[model samples]
Target: MSSSAAPAAPSAIPSEVFEPPVLAEVVRSGFVEGHHRGSLVVLAADGSVELALGDPAAPVFPRSANKPMQAAAVLRAGLDLAGERLALAAASHSGEAFHLELVHTMLAEHGLTADDLRTPPDLPLDPAEAEAYLAAGRVRERITMNCSGKHAAMLAACALNGWDRAGYLDPAHPLQQLVHQVVEEAAGETVTAVGTDGCGAPLMAISLVGLARAFRGFVLAEPGTAERRVADAMRAHPAYVAGTRRPDTWLMRELPGTLSKMGAEAVQAVALADGRALAFKVDDGATRALGPVLARTLRLLGIDAPVVDRIGHAPLLGGAGEVGEIRATF
Candidate 1:
């Protein structure tokens, strides 16, 4: 169920290739001079698309939004992670202290080290955590990077299966083959392109529709299976999934049974308990556009809570008070 070769060159295909429609507008001081182009898709429980915007079929690397699927792959590969550890496997954490501590525990429990991490050394993605680290006269480490959780789990998977922990990040590794198979099966589509991710793991290119389909597939998975285990762990430990004050964490908290994960390049995917799902990407890669777009899309899908409004849209700052906002054009 796996393909050895990369599908095609997603690197050559610019995100602007098909030129997705403007789904959001940036208004500053009452002027509408900028906008974001991207695609959005919502799939109903029966797998029929309830809504579609822009070129939904074009290839887009889902970034960390694909983590849950990747986690499922590790589950199938025989890692017995659950709760916070399992959630962390699918996390794009904000690099909080607890987050780093958990990462350390996982590696220590498995007899691995931060040296085992393949992701680059970097500062915390969480601003306060980064400032605090520097104030303590500490240097940036790979463990502080947001993707350390995912990397630790990859190492743990290697530890679990007695595979080559050294070359686990390689696309040719047996673990990654299982990852590709799980990703394609979850998306119900063949990956059309492949690229190395920011964290150095293989990233498969799937359409926005395919992305939504995958998230939907995850939450709707049957009880007591590997797929459901990933979702359950994430849902039960939202804090580990993205850390304090993050959208995915807050969304999961406020909505309960609803899963939200945002990726780099302004990609967002949310799935409901009933199996409805939405996936989108902003062509300009403005992460600020993510909140408003997802808020409006969820509202369109019948989630009308005020919390979504508060967290989903980005606010415009002024000297005294808010003056403008980034609003969904559609």
Candidate 2:
């Protein structure tokens, strides 16, 4: 995609606007006060700010929001997988049984094993799946970890480049170096800092605007490019992008020509084929807060498709039955 002009600075929010705030129900138990406390930036195809909220210039840790850029580095390094496989590599998945199976398949295809993955082990995100595993007397392995696909991709990159397979996740490793460069280029800014992610890999820090710009570029990327492949894979196989009944999967599957990805905490980013990018962060890092806010943001941007209605307006159930609904007031 062609680069757009730099976005203008965001407007300041008056204190009174936050005082008696217009509380929006972000989740069943949480409400986000009106006026974004972190930052939000919406850019047009030409890179001009169509909408700016909070500190668009503020540097924030995009976390897994940067995964596609990192995957781009793996692609540039000559890793061969594409399509659905590429999408799985960029996902923050729910560790469903099928997701775990694919991770193992990717590892085995490259003659690697779960023992090679450096990410910590965790129980499956689906409660039913976890119970099934326990009932079957299965032990959790790195293959079952949510980040297994990413690690598997790193291993594949190592195999392709003839690099050391062990310690591929090291920040100083060649794979990581390429990842850093790709992220910087995609975001159109240097990473200001680095930190370890919860999944035991390097995390990048870039401004929200930069993050938004990177996603916009991904959607507009040339066909067959790694970036484009990532977008296509995620969109084509939304189930693998997340898991069965996951919001990320539902949103992407429901909306055509839209790409959505979520990061740890409340970081959510979306890019449209029309050259628009939206990025938002909830100040409290409440995971549940993201769905409602994202629905509202898309609505404000005029994306009122049927899928948006289904995913964004999921009913809030009480003890008896349906109580209040999580509504987003534009």
Candidate 3:
């Protein structure tokens, strides 16, 4: 059966709740005007819904949140890396100097070069790193792409599995086939659709519930498998996965068994040890709203602690430095 056709939404958690003004505002106003609608799906490890909001059955592109599943394909195909490296491969990084260096090192290990990467070049996400690169007059290359680690892992899988490296990014390639399978299995449902992502890789469309379930599976993975390895790597080297300043990395590091990934256009996914998976997409793609929503979700999950401390309780600020809190209603 096609993975996309599988039924995966848990029939629990009320669709609507009375929303207070503050919470309602956050959920309604969003980061961009008229595009703030979002869905949150939380699933226990046993596939029970702990909470849900908006259209739980709504189909959305997971974007880079699908990286770990893709990495699972690479691992299942015999690509090997240390836990730290594996975690980095599944990250949507900040393209910092160290992050780029690691990608280069992975390429070298596979006897490849930056020239082999097909991902478009971009300035580092870190302001300091971007300034440094500009000051040094260094031209950004494919190696500096935030998704380079993922691409490098894809190439390594191709090399290890004896698949064609040149077309590894193609959706029909053997590596991508493996990725599709892994995604299907992790999601516990078939992919609804496939589309080209910002980084030029295939993106999977799945329900918010499906995405949350998949992440829950990742966190609860048994030891010695690629899934567990990816999770371990992400927690151990959170800074390298994104940056110390990045919310995704910081949140993951602060929460002992929490695994989180940030995708393009303000998509964030988090999986907790208690078998709960949370996914949220900021409608307008306003990246600023992501942190507060994520923090709010974490709080709802009873994860307050150093995690909150590391994430900090600062209110979201508008462009004028005024407090711009999310007023989620229901």
Candidate 4:
């Protein structure tokens, strides 16, 4: 419980995060070229893995992909947020007007101020918004940070539990302990190692299997339960859950009832209505590979989605128009 608890030993970076035989390739004109290595896991209805690439057992921090479970915990800790509010709590939202306003509203509703947020203030995650802010000479504020919604939820949980709002980001805080409990239960896996997220909250070392399992549980939870509520809310307001142009938002909008969340460092988790799941991490941490990889995995599940074209391929630029593409090699 001490703040001085030794920092976790840095993890050995995996030699390859993706499963065998290169999952994607960069081809220039007529020549075959560079490729990405990563891992993928597809779960059967019975919870057995149907396919695996690379080493799904290797641990990953899962980044924002873990937000739904954290949102579930906040709900468990006492907060009745629903619809867009609930979705935003599990969001890595682009700092759009709706998203920023909602974060402000949540803080105001809980009698907390932006000063109470422990997450560091940063410019908008959306490139356009960031550009606009810079153009207007606007300064960074906690409410406009991508993780503001999640931070607001954390503060609300503190208010509900009568815990110190100022220390809510501490790993040993009652709020975080509740989060750990929810994560373990949802993942059906033991959590050991820890790391700090970009947002400054404690992150757990969990394998792709555990991450997949967590999302599987979320999709299949009892209709009226907190887990199901989070899933439903995210599905209902996919736009708020991510942004106007994000894969999470697109997938949820185009494929209703699918639970989708992406994390930092190329981590992604997607679950079907029946609780089956796929979770993966791109070895090189290439965000470019995520769309193609997830699209391929979904194809294996018998879905022929059109969004694949929108997100899957990474184009190679050349003088004479399009000269190359990043195609899935697997």
**Top-lDDT structure, candidate number:** 1
Error of 1 at 38 (Å): 0.5
Task: Find the candidate with the highest TM-score and give its number.
Answer: 1
Better of 3 and 4 by lDDT: 4
Q: What is the full ranking by lDDT, best candidate first?
A: 1, 4, 2, 3
* Per-residue lDDT of candidate 2, residues 1-330 (tens digit): 999999998999676653212224534445432232355678887877887776666777787787888778888889887766888888777778778888889989989988889888877766777788778898877777777788889889999899988878778989999888888888899899988887787888888888898989889999998788888888888787778867788878877777888888678889987878898776667565577768777887888777676666645666977655655444
A best-first ranking of the candidates according to their TM-score comes to: 1, 4, 2, 3
- When 2 and 3 are scored with lDDT, the better candidate is 2
Q: How close to the true structure is residue 233 of candidate 4, measured as C-alpha lDDT? A: 98
Who is ahead in lDDT, 1 or 3? 1
Give candidate 2 misplaced runs (Cα > 4 Å): 1-37, 314-318, 325-330
For each candidate in the order shown, give its overall lDDT on alpha carbons.
0.89, 0.78, 0.77, 0.88
TM-score of each: 0.93, 0.86, 0.85, 0.91
Q: Please give the TM-score that candidate 2 achieves against the real structure.
A: 0.86
- When 1 and 4 are scored with lDDT, the better candidate is 1
Model 4, residue 22: C-alpha shift (Å): 2.1
- Which stretch of 10 consecutive residues in model 4 shows the poorest summed lDDT? 16-25
**Which segments of model 1 are wrong by more than 4 Å?**
1-18
